[model samples]
Target: MRTPLDSPFSPGSDTVPQVWAGRTAQLSDWRDVVRPRRLAGLPERGRTILGEAGLGKSSLVRKIAADAARRGDWVTPQLRIPSGTDPLKRVAVALLDVARQAHLATSREKRIGTLLDRVEAVAAAGVSLTLREQQGPEPYSTLTELLVEIGRAAIRRGDVMVLIHIDEVQNIASEDALSQLLVALGDALTHEEDVEVPGGMLIARTLPLAVYLTGLPEFADMAGARKGATFARRFRTTTLGPLGDDDLASALQPFLVEGWEISDDREGATRVFMEPEARAAIVDLSRGEPFLFQLAGEQAWYAGTGDVITRDQVIRGWGGVRSEAAAHVERILARLPSREREFLEEMAGLEPADRTLTTIARKMGLRRGSDAGPTSQRLDSVRGIITRGKPYAFRHRAVEAYLTTYWPDPPAGDAERESTSAEGIG
Candidate 1:
């Protein structure tokens, strides 16, 4: 059976291989950031990898782990959590899962039984074991105990370094929970503390273990800022941006035949893959985003029956592109409160320079004046709406399109007038 990694269209697609070609610069940056410094007998600080959704953050982390494992320097474990659970519990489960998978315990049953034993031990010590319930004051101490145990196990096996990777760090609702978790792990790795009894492990001789956090840019900011001095200062931050034109072409090369590839037909292929104007349109729309570019290409590719993609295919594929963009915008918007959503609707209607607070507030039925100062602050308060200093721009062009199509117009009570007003504003 062909793996999903083999094709872009398949479910469970593992895009890590293509990620190198598509996001070469990003991959290289991540490699430099994650390279262990322990060859010289110095412990490398843990890293926080940041990128927007679908911008290959997870792929970069996976690549780093694969590379590290291949070099035999570390044990890499990937942990994923389902939605709507305390992240600390998710982290605990992931750690236990990693231990079990490594087969350090004598038997499969023994591994889980050992984990349960530790959980009970910690709980009996007044740490909360209730995964779904609120964490008690001792949750941080409990996590600290767990990390110390894992570090001891790693040392026993002669593995001096262990990397625990947590994906989708933004999904966790409690900033304090994340903060507590990081603080506990950071203390375990850096602080000279000893765990006593069944939970206590030898401190100085234990190997170093690092926790890697991965998520969108906003989540990283939230985690870093909310975690304050302790967790924030302990880890390094790495941001992943969009692929450059050359790297973008490289990313697509594997799916294309040698001479007939899109790079060879750059201009014509772009026009075909997007509208005649869509070459620029899609680029502006995607902001050089990897997934959006691939989405646009996929739409055009599927629309074309022959070997070459054409402008007609791109035009036909616009529906698919727009649909994907709308869905993405809805997801982002769903997280916002009603007032913010109203702010977004108003902000979406503004032209590049016209998205100042005065204009947005006026449109949202807030204020009638041309003053840009207070209104700007008010608009800025709306998350994901406008970046500071820059003209109000949707994070993605697909979002702009969605806002244009779906968000109801200001209460003019006239569809024709609203259409005219929207086009005029644009």
Candidate 2:
């Protein structure tokens, strides 16, 4: 008999799960679109992944970076968006750190040495500028210089690719900083130069850098609104959400396909399989949201009794973690703007089959459904908090359940209101 496996699910923020699923379009875009464009020296291209928190935006980007690393690309550490004056200093540090690990020929070593000095100088300048004292060269200027040079050297080598993955892009505070970094990236990407190759002088793209960015849709929308369409249109935008039923099942059954690894140091942490009934039960409990899916999977593993997970075990596991799942949903709600939450509350107050824009408007005491159109659209597009339909729906059933539990029930209809007023004191 085989031992039961440890919890292979990742329930935390930005952590990649053992079983990957439902990202065929995104994964293909990275490989087919970005990878091919980069290799062919076509126009600059990459992906900007925008979604609500816990939709695995960061995790998706990390997965891409990991794939690049496996393909022997020169990859940088995951850099979070910078705050202010020390903008992109993290970029320098991450790039240089990875580059330092390379063992190259003497000439290439000297070239890398020069790049390292520029990176250090850029980092120092940013630090100095942060302290309100400019000692070295300007941070933004030198940052641009260093990144371009790094990209150029990589292209000259003609061996490996360079990938920079950024997380928490919503935290970017400085417009000037963002604009400057974009400028540097644009310059590097569009650079055309004749370099000495093994055979002869041939025109080549100077820098072959690919970027993958992850952040909240709210921030992406706000930045684009503030900084113009360039910020939004810089990359192929992908909006993420919870996995669908089929995809969720795929996520649960990763090991069945072979070559998938689950590494854990715990006793009885080898392998396990779920009955279809059990997998469906877990999926229903998850409400198609990833955080809950992961949380439930994690708890299911802990509460699991045998090598084969049964529906009863899935139920027992979820029973242990339902409260935690509710709290997670509440946190998601608490983070939303007041209007968005109010909209959700209005929707939740109604029956699931009656959750239309008009019903939501009525619950919110608005005169016409059109009055709520913009807000509804914002909620749907910005973070996918609510989806649109004849009878609208939330991104997850758990969210609707959470809202209904706390918010007041829908108010009396027009007929009820008229009936009550007419009969008063009569």
lDDT tens digits, residue span 162-233, model 1: 677887777766655666667766776564434243555643332356567787556655765667676656
Relative to the unseen true structure, what is the C-alpha lDDT of residue 184 in candidate 2, on a scale of 0 to 100? 55
Error of 1 at 141 (Å): 4.0
Model 1 lDDT, full chain set: 0.54
| Residue pairs in collision within model 2 | none
Candidate 2 CA-lDDT value: 0.68
CA deviation > 4 Å runs, candidate 2: 1-5, 81-87, 101-115, 125-138, 193-206, 254-270, 396-398, 404-426
Candidate 1 clashing pairs?
A: 195-200, 196-200, 275-278
- Candidate 2 lands at a TM-score of 0.81
Scored against the true structure, residue 382 in model 1 reaches a CA lDDT of 21
**Model 2 lDDT tens row, 1-426:** 222454567787676677676787888877877776776566665567888767778888788888888987888777877544445677667766655544322335575566567667655554345345445554555555655665555665765678888777777676655666655555555556565655786756545678777787866664567757565455666678777878888877753334234454565334566777777877777766787778777766676545666665566666667678777777888888887788899888788899999989988889999999988998887777789987898875567656765311112242354345447624
